[model samples]
Target chain A: MSDRDLIIDRYKDLLKTYLKGKSETALYKGQQFSRKLIEQQISPDDVLSDHVSVLHELFPDMSEELKDSFDFLLEVMIGYGFAYREHQSLRTRQRQLESEIEVAASMQQTLLMSDVPTVDGLDIGVKSVPAKKMNGDYFNFVKDHKSVSIAVADIIGKGIPAALCMSMIKYAMDSLPEQRMQPNLLLENLNRVVEQNVHPNMFITMLYGLYDTDLHEFYYAGAGHEPGFFYRASEDRFEDMFAKGLVLGVSRQTRYKEYQLRVNLGDMIILLSDGVTECRTSKGFIERDEIVDLIRAHMHKPAQEVVESVFNELERLQEFELRDDFTLIILKRKV
Target chain B: MNIQSCVEVCNEWDIVSARQLGRNMAKELGFGNVDQARITTAISELARNIYLYAGNGKICIEAAEKMGKRGLKIIATDNGPGIKDIRKVMEDGYTTSGGLGAGLPGVKRLMDEFMIDSVVGSGTEIIATKWLR
Candidate 1:
């Protein structure tokens, strides 16, 4: 065959591969071949002329009207190429995004699912569940020379924004000066940072407490967080260690007030987010007393068992679906 | 705001999670799309190292500030076998695990700050930071 026939043969193979796989790589290869054809000084009309001659040679009895449709075929192929390319890119972008969220969730899991610290005479058990891929609940522990600072923060929103808000809380808390390990002081510092960076509409409730191992004393503060429950094993009575303060990011000048608790042997300090206490019952929202009662029943069990039992109760109450992030932590001094 | 850090490691899932956390954070810090992609890629590389070399490790993603500039920081810590030759690993396309050999060196190029510490038998730690523009 002539040189022109060889060129058409190469073109035919390229088009066949593209049609078979519909791969972007193959499409671009076909494009490169077209470019080379042009560089050899072959015009589009000349290619068309050769195509027609080849068609006629193959189909000698073909009518003129049927022979002229290659132009229309070429036009359709061009449109298909653009649409197919766009669709492939979109699919790739979506896959990348899905994996990104998965990765973020994994990091959140690793961060939140850390092993509960094994203090010499204390038992710690915690559980957290996110209503979505991005959790709005966060818990962390910071240790000083003689004491440990524990914090549980809840962002008021859901999804990505809420998740990001939790990270902000973490960084701001991590950046605080060690000299200000007091609950109220740490909350105040975190408040300033959140108030500066976060929008007014989004607020965060946080409970921060410092436990002095030597003194067996716990100083805690609440920033519009849920009232903490403390069981007095001596009196067989439950005490609500609630403090007054505005939530973070609501006001720049808000100051959290700290409260003191002398943790005794077998005393349990239970902290939770609204997702647990606000679990809707048949009548309405479950009250704080129910959670306290449950903890009181499980007072003799391990800290982890208590948290697990409470979670099971919450899920039973909210059988439809969780509407918020769930977090529950129990710190018990076991003498 | 309340803040604290969590340190734990599981499997390759953690690596993917670290990369995603870094990418989302880069966006939250107002990083451009290009920078976000770069941060995600870098985290994946570092996290993959943890998965491949250490068997299991923890990856931490945090927002950091220096002077007035804000950025994202990622730390991958593992108790896996340490690299015998740091200089060789830093060279592109030099991998011991039959990987693309782009793990550490590519991560170094993608981030604004990169530091690594490793022992002979204890483990390896790679820390990378990318500042948002």
Candidate 2:
């Protein structure tokens, strides 16, 4: 090869390094070398052409094989760069979606969360877990002088629509006057609101209970929801607390029946979404007896610990991946 | 055509699944929306009966054809305490539990054929079949 060819080869090596490293020093040196090549009357395009020839010279026996090797490699690198750009954009989009869900979840959590009314003579504990980013389980506490009203509802569906319905329930509940002390009245009113506003396809199973400390009575109603458990300390037995009512949003005029329970000292009232009792075991689903047994074991603890222990035990039974929204509320009557 | 589906009716959520299974089978059997709705409602009542009385049970949904006409069949079985009086249960407003008492009679009215076999201590099995016109 001629002296000019050798110089062009050196430029090719330097330019490759400059492109690879994106090094400013390599770029500056390359600029200086290009200027020197210009000064010496050598063309830069000739150097690029010589780069291919250099490979050909190295593979003299395979000259024809190496002929378009550099161009092919450059083409492959350009395709790789396009794919890399696409990958980066996808990653960015994924991150944005994840963060958006996080924001929505937090916002929904705030909407679902309410101050557990610290009523006199009652220790209340509540917990909720969504199987997905959004939960359909709901619980609320509204208190007056004589009674603290509690509502635990599970939407018949999941995701955003259920979340929206839950908000509707909260507002409907707040719109009621204080005269709606009766659980049956509260549920009836709430059902009317749901039936009028929400889509017919969507429904809710709810249990509304108003515990009157003054009367030592707990008035409760159920709208096709799972029965809550009442632990009678005096009898050393469990009584299922349930009332007859259809699911909300089914009919506008549907009336819920109310039942009364005497909330005795040391007795416990537990309300849970079906997710708690329907926790999928290897067999299919956990039995209510198992749930009662677990609660009985933790009956000695505070309301908060009862919820925690029951949740932990149920989660263990299901291997920690809850497939539905879990909502539990425990109200303990202290002596 | 005999397409069948079996689901465990343990809780209220399972009752919903059982209802859906009945409707879906009806849909597959080419039943119209009204029939499908009736089948779903019947399944809901029956499934709730299993859940409320038995605590845990199973429901089988099947699509059947007889004399060149298609139909749907539902069989709900539970090991729960058997009903002492099947005839009384079929009477409207006869609820042993806290239910609305419209379940058994409502189910019987919804289907063309209904049969129940129950023993006091053993279990209860109710089968209902509806034929498409």
Calculate DockQ per candidate and list them. 0.01, 0.01
Q: Any runs in candidate 2 off by more than 4 Å, and if so which?
A: A1-87, B1-133
What CAPRI-style quality would you assign to candidate 1? incorrect
Q: Enumerate clash totals for all models, in the order shown.
A: 4, 0
lDDT of 1 by residue, A1-335 (tens): 98767998877667667767999999899788878875675644345555555566656899767754754454333333323333444456689889999999888777654456767778998888888888998888766567777888888888889887777777777688663567898888888898899988999999998899889999998999987788888898888878799998887789778899999998888888888888887878888888888887776888999899888877877885888889999999987
User: lDDT at A101 for candidate 2?
Assistant: 85
How well docked is model 2, in DockQ terms? 0.01
Computed on alpha carbons, the lDDT of every model, listed in order, comes to: 0.77, 0.81
Can you tell me the CAPRI class of model 2? incorrect
Error of 2 at A9 (Å): 15
Which 10 successive residues of model 1 chain A have the least lDDT summed? A76-85
Q: Distance from true position, residue B4, model 1, in Å?
A: 69
